[model samples]
Target: MNQPVSGFSKKSKAEKIEWLAENYLQNNLRSVQVLKNYWNDDPSLQQLHDDFIENTLSNYYLPFGIAPNFLINEKLYALPMVTEESSVVAAASNAAKFWLERGGFKAEVISTEKNGQIHFNFFGSEKVIEAFFEEIKPKLHSSIQAIEKNMKARGGGLLALSLVDKSHILEGYFHIHATFETLDAMGANFINTCLEQMAHTFEEEARNFEAFQKKVTYPEVVMSILSNYVPECLVRAEVSCNVEELTTKHHEGKHFAEKFVRAIEIAKTETRRAVTHNKGIMNGVDAVVLATGNDFRAVEAGVHAYAARNSYYSSLTHAKIEDDVFTFWIELPLAVGTVGGLTSLHPLTKLAFEILQKPDAKELMQILAVAGLAQNFAAIRSLVTTGIQKGHMKMHLMNILNQLHATEAEKEKAMEHFMKNTISHSAVVDFLGKLRL
Candidate 1:
């Protein structure tokens, strides 16, 4: 679990490194082995790599130093996230808290059977699936029956299936689709295993054709491998806050929320704006995904892919006013993990999980959803007020000033040239020299 002050100890770098290693490896040889094997045993290098990997992995705990006061459909939450953008936690937390201060941000998330997809190719004519579904759909029950020992015991089962026409990404090459509902598992391993077993049986039954691939899918997948992105399972969060709470500067969070709402569309954009836009979301999602050791890149890809789900690809979240109060919302596939991950091994990741007290999968999704929402708020706030580059460039110039040991006047000058948005270290140095400090 991450500490309230993550890495804020006044301990020496050496001591901090030791703490990280012990937490990450259980003092295992694996940490030392990988350290020596890959990093040439450079303590500094290993520490840096650990920081990057873990932050990239379990980095969700970094943002929101001051927790938000918000209610999701009347449920209370204290959200933590890891991101660099300004005003996200402050904005979302303040917004939610402001609403709750008067009443609360009430909302609901509808439920559905969570599922991934499987695709099979039989090397025969594409028309075969029409005749084949009648034969195989019945047998799918028996196959599910075999796996029911553990799943049924847990109060879940194979839910349903539907065959989809093949989608061709390549010329003259296509496949068939089957969506099987694996209840409550997040269905990563179970669905894939069951489908593979079913595919082998199909191959035997068909006898004349070859079965190529059987795997899960994303928002819309062709079946190479199934991502846990289940479009059918959507949880929508609706919220409300009084305008008095919003405009009160101190308590009227929606007052700012409205100003932000009208002005913040730049943050909701795709294209050049979408890069950092999505990056900020990853700041929250990737950290949670990492803490649980889920394949974050897959989750990352699916999220952006789904963000572009409509004719126009845009933001992961939406905000508006409702019920005489301000409201915010986000609906995206949150395929994050909770147990059976590298968190127990990676020192920082483990610590982050510790800070969170290791919330269960559903609870973890709530945390991640909050993070995504906050990150979105931060990005949009910046885009509307000044532009996304101002604060980021400020930090970049600060780093350059540190390296150059430039004077105060030189630092100020360098900051200006830097904010001109050149995005080069050389430009910072040139401005520093011109100051002659």
Candidate 2:
């Protein structure tokens, strides 16, 4: 049994690795070597990564890929995506190409307001509390003026502050809901700072208010924080063409369009299908989100919540065919930043922004929505025509070969053989065995 190490974070990188190897890895030399092998060759770059977080052992890596020929709003873009999954970039690239001849993707920012809350409990009279909130609302806004000075100078800052009474849900519960425009930054730290300042000011004012002094219990602040759910921060992306233009060598255009519409309908009506269907959309959305150093986890949480906003989980993408016209679109609530957090600090993230032509926050939102729509278009096209497994398994072939420890010559032969044969783990193993024999 291993004991909990004391002051583990205080140890140097070498000492921490040695301790981990001894206690957790049974002092395996190869395992220790594996950790060191991933360290950056450049010392300054390695130090930069180490300073990003505590307990830094080694840098984890994912492939940084680009999907070219994305035409959004009549502008061309090559999207940068970072992911570990195979075929995601390929699928996005294929989708982009397919749409290029059909007017590509059209995307626009619907809104750009983010929000935070100062939650508190007031055990006093409802009327008194409401009156107090109305009186102190302006004061709360003034409290955060200095904190939001820079953001305001850039045409973004606090938009509104309102009091929400949730005493019906929980006794004595209320919140100060605040909306903001954060411009080109993700603004987590900025929003949070403003919320805390307002919360402090709110509590302080409540203490001095005559009505609150008359009450036995004063207003108590439970917490102050920014919300990941930004339904107001939204973007819409779509692609459309004549229904007959969807034709490919494998399937007729009319048949493909109807089948694609049916597939989206199934996803909307069924929860299980909706989960996987939306996950496919995220495979594209999250890859771009990660590459640009935005918060994928926040985007994921907010997106799923938006899907269920109608009280049931449903597909994020929609399709329609009417009067010989076929249109597909997705409206996503994405709050992404282009100027703050890891966006500026991470070397690859800076390069990703450059690759994207340095879009502002609104433009980034548009790009993210387009990526999701393109991804879903590719996935549904594959599913409705040749089936998903054929293309997915083909992309997964390299990983299988590496797992089998196939030589360069063996891998080439295996790729050729699988091109005309069904691909499965067992089938690959058998083919490799036969080749070796």
Candidate 3:
């Protein structure tokens, strides 16, 4: 039987580990050792990691890799990627090199607007609430001035405040919808702070107002939070070249371009294919987002919402061929920050920024968008020509070798054999068996 324990967080790291091992792990020494093995060698670094979250045990690691020769907006970058997938880095690098010989990727930040809400329950007259909102709009901005001081000095802060009436849809539901521009920061904390302050001021001021005082209808402040759906904080990245430039090993340039456009059209019409197609794009976007220590989850949420913005989910990347030129591009809402949070805290995050030449928020947005575009191009290229599994299974060979517990000599022979032969689990196993015999 499991039991809840109080003061669990107050326990020391060793004590917490011991309790977990004893209670849940059945006192398995190997399990305990595995956790301990992942701890940082330096005590200070271990402490820093432990402080990052609650109930810290040991660090979970993902492979950090680099895809070089990415030419975005006439500048070169070696994009840092952190992922567990075997083929993502390789695919991104292939696309980067492919485009490098042509014109490279072009990227731009379309907007930088973020939003939040102060949700509340108001049972007052609709007319009264609307008039009150009009009166309190300026005060809402004034209340959060102290919080916005530094953000404004950097040319980023609260931009607009509006009252939204949702009482018709959901009884007594009203909100203060606020917009912000946080510049280089992701601005979650900043936007939420302003929202909460504005909410507090609204409630306090409403109590003193004559209509509210006479009628005793006080709006109940429910919550204040930032929205991850940042449709306005968008970036676009594209790669374009003459149709002749799209020639690959297996197909002529014009034929390849025709097949590629048709493939995108299928993804646009089919939900199942669109889901996987967009997921491939995120493989590149998320890798860079993680390496740079930005919020990949938030980026994912915003991007998927944008995909379904037209009442049906569809491909994030689009392909077109016209005037003897083939173009492939993606435009997505990515609200990621270059500073603050893990970017300044994690050592590798600092290194990632240095490798990127210290791009600002807009520059980082552009680079991330290009990463996604490159990844999609590689995936679609593979799908339209040689098929996806050939490369994917080849890249997955090491994982299979590790699972089979093959020796160094056996792995070397297996690698050589698979280079000339098709890779499959049964094939590898049979080869190993024959080698053993």
Q: Which candidate, 1 or 2, has the higher TM-score?
A: 2
Best by lDDT: 2
TM-score of each: 0.64, 0.99, 0.98
TM-score of candidate 3 on Cα atoms, chains taken together:
0.98
lDDT of 2 by residue, 76-192 (tens): 999999998898999999999999998999998888899999999987788998999999999999999899999999999999999899999999999989999998989899999
In terms of lDDT, the poorest run of 10 residues in model 2 is 209-218
Order of the predicted models by lDDT, top scorer first: 2, 3, 1
How close to the true structure is residue 292 of candidate 2, measured as C-alpha lDDT?
A: 98
lDDT of 3 by residue, 178-257 (tens): 89999999988888888989989999989888888789898889999999999999999999999998876778999999
For candidate 3, the lDDT comes to 0.93
Local accuracy by lDDT, each model? 0.56, 0.94, 0.93
| Clashes within 3 Å, all models in order | 26, 0, 0
Model 2's TM-score against the true structure: 0.99
Candidate 1, 318-361: lDDT as tens digits? 76766666666677666555544454555555566666666655
Report the C-alpha displacement of residue 323, candidate 2, in angstroms. 1.2
Ten contiguous residues minimizing lDDT sum, candidate 3: 242-251
